[model samples]
Target: MARDADATKVRILAAATDEFAAHGFAGGRVERIAARAQSNVRMIYAYYGGKSGLFDATVAEALRRMAENVPPRPQDLAGWAGDVFDHHQRYPEVLRLSMWAQLERPEAGAEPREIYEDKALAVATVAARPLSPIDVLVFIYAIAQAWQLSPGGLTGLEEDPAGGDGVAARRQSVVVAVERMVHAQP
Candidate 1:
């Protein structure tokens, strides 16, 4: 039945997410994904065309999940930053996978770039009418990456240092600062 087929596809995708998260695309094996999904290799190819297609699907799905968690809000930069910071904490693997995709093939990141640009433009709409959506997107992502990496500051956002409350506060501060920079009145 169509329902059965859909269920199988979902299973494969879920399994693939985990496998790919643990291992980069070059390292991920189809057999491992099939086994984890409790399905067969044939099913994966049938539904996703091939490993490349599956990887693209997985990347798209991860971006979709992030978008769902952080909806577009022109005046909710703090909330959006928190959502994104938390998303990175909860699903760091997604970030790693995306990084891998970018390093492996820059073109592969185009679709996700478009998704992020559209979402960011919606949030930063109050900025100068001619704001480059790509710039806004890069700014948001750069902030998130800085917070996540925290070079000389916090290590991991989830693990609050002895006294530091959490990464949320630090992230909120950065978000507000960036908002001012992006939406500054001309």
Candidate 2:
């Protein structure tokens, strides 16, 4: 029974992830999620309370998966940046989901202070100097996501075809930028 319950929850969460990623919290439909998951609306409410609850859970799960899959490596910040960029490129829905959450439920997505504190501590442990880890992290993340968020603004790939190497060039630019940031003197 516990196994069945867990399986049901996984299915529901998977379905919810797709729905929320595609339609966001405001546009996502509980009925569509239920049908996709082969579960009923009551089960969704019982498991997740409501659409907001489900969205929160979905976002939380996505974050957890990201952390597990591509943890930060202060020793190799450039590699880590590339990995993060690759992950974002492959799973763009994660970014979309985050953007949707921020746009639709600004107040709800505020991560707990402890999460930030823990990350800061982790960064401090591996970082070379006393530079703020958060700053480094944010810069690397922004560089990695910039192309995806607004390719035309950064690389002009959207307007002109720089051949098939444009994406590779953009990715290399992110890696080089991260390398510079990591090596730069504070």
lDDT of 1 by residue, 29-56 (tens): 9999999898999988999998988988
Judged by lDDT against the true structure, how good is candidate 1? 0.73
Error of 1 at 7 (Å): 1.4
- Best TM-score goes to which candidate? 2
Model 2 CA deviation exceeding 4 Å by range: 1-3, 110-116, 127-130, 151-164
In candidate 2, residue 181 scores what lDDT? 80
| lDDT tens readout by residue for model 2, 73-116 | 87888888888888897788778888888899879962334545
lDDT of 2 at 92: 81
- Backbone clash pairs for candidate 1 read none
Question: How high is the CA lDDT of each candidate model?
Answer: 0.73, 0.80
Worst 10 residues of 2 by lDDT: 110-119
Error of 2 at 55 (Å): 0.4
